[model samples]
Structures are given as structure tokens and as C-alpha cells.
Target: MGNKTALYDKHQEMGAKLVDFGGWDMPIHYGSQVDEHHKVRQEAGMFDVSHMTVVDVTGTDAKEYLRYLLANDVAKLQQKGKAMYSGMLNEDAGVIDDLIVYLMTEPGVAGEWFRVVVNCATREKDLRWMSDQTASFDDVALTEQPDLAMVAVQGPKALELAKQSVSESRATLIDQLSVFQGLESEGWFIARTGYTGEDGLEIMLPEDEVADFWQALADAGVSPCGLGARDTLRLEAGMNLYGADMDETVSPLAANMGWTIAWEPQERIFIGREALQAKKEAGISEKLVGLVMESRGVLRAHQKVVVSGVGEGEITSGTFSPTLGCAIAMARVPSATADQAEVDIRGKLVPVRVIRPSFVRNGKKVFD
Candidate 1:
């Protein structure tokens, strides 16, 4: 048995197929995974994301500490509630984890605060690493918010239906939240963020309040989704999974994360700055790219990718895209790889076309 979230009983009541994910008992699906996926794309769906770790960094030195901690400059976040996606890297330029950090207060102001949300699978290691990095900063403090529960309400109608579930005041606040921004109301943090590549809100509230709120959203016609659908949705959206897409052994340059690294203010030294500079100077050997199967076969992780005369690579994350009606994948291949390749499925070589990593966004095909 693994740890259970606040909605464990509710999931059981809904007949969710439970599976152990990163030592936590999580719902894989309620009944049909495909239906849940379609529900989110066509209408609205809610997911229990309480298993993710949320840590609040506050104090006088919060900004300075984070500037040194994340590859992306938090100094760029001049407005409160603004968010930036960043990769926390190691000294070797290897990706420790990719996370979203929201500036809770205006930059350069006293008592500036930042909120970081990391993946559940790397929770323990990430916390330990973060603590070690911040040990030298006496004025910085890290507080883990285990008492909070997070739910992501996503899709076209997600925001509208979600507004009906929250307080009237919060609904107004939600209406004002811009993309990649967040606001707090009535002790709940509502962020205009999601993993499904759709417009939605990720709400974090008191653990005790989540069940009722989730139930309210369901009653309001939002479908209850599970991790199984979440995976497919994110894949279609071209979002990277923590472990499957990249890990401690991979550098951001090779992981389709180079854009997240802030290079300006060149004097500001963050972790892995030296290694990343060296990698940049030496030229990256491999790059992460998108693959679409032209032949009739499913693409999956660990499948060998043959880039003709270039070199071999492997699929990092692949799936039968429900929205695209075909197989799509993200793979790490030689930087010289062209627009065509072949994937080794079982013993047979299947033809695939290489393109930009994104397949679909906002229910439309993004790549040709």
C-alpha cells in the first residue's frame, strides 16, 4: 500500500482504478480512459493533483536565493502573481527538475515571496536538494504546504464550470487571472495554469475543502479525470514528464528545455551555469524532437530511433495520440537529424516523420 490523497475515498466511490504512482495511490482512470481524454478536450474535466509538492519560499532574501537557485531569472518577474517555467539544474548542468515558480510579490520589494510546484515522483530528492542549496541563506525559509490540496479543472468549458463551484468573490478573481498568472482569494490559490495544453485553472485550497469543491465541480458537469488521461493530454500538448522526458543524467540543452534557461544578466551565477556554458561552447550532440509514425504502429518509450546515416536515438515519451488519431512521440536524436527517421518497434522498423515537438494545442493540430 502507498500513501493516499485526501480524495482517496472519493475516488474509490467513483470506481476509479487505483495504481501506485511514485509511492502514492493514485487514480489511473474511473472506467474508460479514452472517454475521459475526450471529455477534457471537448468539454471540461477535473484532476486530483494533490500529490504534487508545493513549497513556499518567503523572507527578505527570497528573491536572491531563487535567482541563484533556478536557471531562469526570477528577477524578470516584476509583477506579483506572474509565473515562469524553469529548470533547477545541478552543477553538471544536468536537469534536477523542471518546475513552475510563481512570484507571489513584486520583485525588489521587501518580504518578496515565491511559490514552487515540483513533480510528485521527485519530491524527496528535490526537497533535500533544495534544502542543501538554501542552507547558506539565513534569511530564506522554505515551508512545505502538505495541508493543501490541488485540483486542475481543464478544457474549453473548464473555467466557466469551475467558476460556478468556487465562491462568487473567487470567481471574479478567476476571471481576471491571465495566462501563466495566479491570484489568491479566500485562502485559495487559483492559477490560470494546466498540463492539458488547454485553458484552465489549477486551484489549491485547504485539504478539508477540496472534497466539497471537487464534488461541486462534478455536480456542475465537469467530468472527473484520472492520471491515465492526464498523460495522454500532456503528451498531445508536448509537455515533458519529469522522469520519462528528462532526468538527472540529461542536460537542458538536450532535453528541449534550453529556452527555459535565462542567459541574460550574465554575471548572475546560478547552479550549472559553468557546465551549461561549456556544453554550449562544445556544441550539443543530441536534441529532443517530435516524431509522428507514418506507418501503422504504436510508438512507445525506449523504442530505437534510426536517423538514417546520422546516429541512433530513442523515444523518450510516445503515445497513440487520441486527438491526432495517430502515434506521436518525443525523441532524443542526433542534432543533425533531418525531417525523416525510422523507429524500431519490436523487431520491425517503422517509418516516422520528424517535426516540432508539439502535436496539438487548443484542440487543433499544431504540427503538419
Candidate 2:
């Protein structure tokens, strides 16, 4: 037996195929993974994301503490509810984890608060690392919000359909939120964010109310999606998976996350600054890129990529893109590699085109 979310029974009731995901028994699919994937792309689908860890950082020194903890500068968040994606790094410029931090209070305000959502698999290590770092800061406090359950409603009609499940007041708030922004109403926090590269809301509310809320969404015509579809959707969107694309051993720069680093205000000084600065000076030897297999056969992780005259690399994440009707992958290869490469599948060398990692956005293909 594994840990189960508040909606575990609901998933089983819907005939979901349950599997162990990072110690949690999660739904892989209700029936057909492809159908669930298409439902999100064509209409609305909801996913139980309560397995993700949510932590609240509060107190007078909260802002200062986060500025030192994340590679991205939280000082750039000028408004409350604004969210920023960042990479928490180690002293050696290696990625500890990638997360989203929401500024919960107004800028330059006392009693400042911030909400951080981290990968469930890295929850223990991340909490320990955060605790050790905050030991020296007496004014800041960290509290894990285990009482909250999160649900992601996504796709073209996600916002409209999700609104039917909440109150009219909450619906209005959800309609007004901009991309990457969030707002709290009636004890529920709704954010205009999603993993599917589609317009959606990730709502966090009291755990006890989640089952009823999920049932309401289902009644409102929102399809119940599972982890299998979630993986394919995020892969098509070119989002990095925690353990597959990068880990404690890999730097953000090599994981296509260099853009997440805030280099200005040189004095802000966050963890891994020294090592990142040194890497910048020395020049990065490898980088993450997108691979398109127009040829037959599927792409899978750990597949060897040969860049003609350049050195070899490996596929970090790969899948058959439902939207593109082809296989796509993200790979770490020699920085000098050009637009062409060959993926070693089994014993055969298959030609592939290298491009930017993002293959789709807003339900449309972004690559040529």
C-alpha cells in the first residue's frame, strides 16, 4: 500500500488504473491514456495534484530568506499573487529542484508571506534543506500545509468548465486572474497555472472538501485525467521532469533552465551563484535541446544521440506527441551540435532533427 490523496476513492470509483508514483498510489488513467490526453487538448480535464507538497513561508524576513534560497529573484514580483518559476540549487550550481513560488503579500510589506510548491518526490530532502538554511534566520518561519488538496483543471474549456464547480464569486476571481497569477477567495486559492501548456486553474482548498469538489467537476462535464496523460501532456509542452531531466548532479544551465536564473543586482547572492558564475565564464559544454523523430519508431529516455562530429548525448525525456502525431524528445547534447543528429535506437542509428525544446503551446504546434 502507498500514500493516497484525498481523491483516491473518487479515482477508483471512476475506474482509474492506480499505480505507485513517488510513494503515492495515483491514477495512471481511467481507461485509455490517449483518450484522456485528447480530452485535455480538445476540451477540459481535471487532475488531482494533491501529491505535490505546499509550504508556506512567513514572517518579517521571508522575502530576504527566499531571495537567498532561489536562483530567480523574488524581488521582481511587484504584486501580490504573482508567481515565478525558479530553480533551487546547491552550492555547486547543481539543481536541487525546480519549483514555483507565489508572492502571497504585497511588496515591501511587513509580515511578508510566500507559498512554495515543490515536487513530491523531493519533498523530504527539500524540506530538510530549507530548514537548515533557515536556521540562521530567526524572523522567518516555514510551515507545510498538509491540510490542503490541489486540483488542476486544464485545456481550452478548462476555465469555463471549472467555474461551474465553484461559487459565482470564486468564478469571477478565476476569470480575472492573469497568466501566472493567483488569488485566494473563500479559503480557496486558485492559480492561473497548469502543467499541460493550456489555460487552466490549479485550485488548492481544504482537503476534506476535495472529493465533493472533484465530483462536482465530473458532473460539470470535466473529464477525470490521470498521471499517464499528465506525463504525455507535460512532455509535449517541454517541461522538465524532476529526476529524469535533472537532479542534484545536473546544473540548471545544462537542463535548459539557464533562463530561470536572475543574474542582475549582483549583490542578491543566492546559493550556487559562485559555481554558476564560474560556469558562465568557462562557457557551458552541453545544453538541452528538442528532438523531432519524423521517422518511424518511438523515442525513449536514455537513448544515445550522436551529433555527427560532435560528442554523444542522451535523451532525458521522450514521448509520442499526441498533438504533433510524431515522437518528440528533450536531450542533453554538446553545445556545438547543430540542427541534425542521430538517435541510437536498439542497434540502429536513426536521424533526428534538433530544435528548441518546446513542441507545442496553447494546443498548437510551435515547431516547424
Question: Candidate 1 on 169-258: residue-level lDDT in tens?
Answer: 999998999998998999999999999999999999999999999899989999999999999999999899989999989999999999
Top candidate by lDDT: 2
Q: What is the TM-score of each predicted model, taking all chains together?
A: 0.99, 0.99
Computed on alpha carbons, the lDDT of every model, listed in order, comes to 0.93, 0.94
Error of 2 at 9 (Å): 0.6
lDDT of 1 at 141: 88
- Kindly report which residue stretches of model 2 are placed more than 4 angstroms away from their true locations once superposed: none
Candidate 2 least-lDDT 10 residues: 103-112
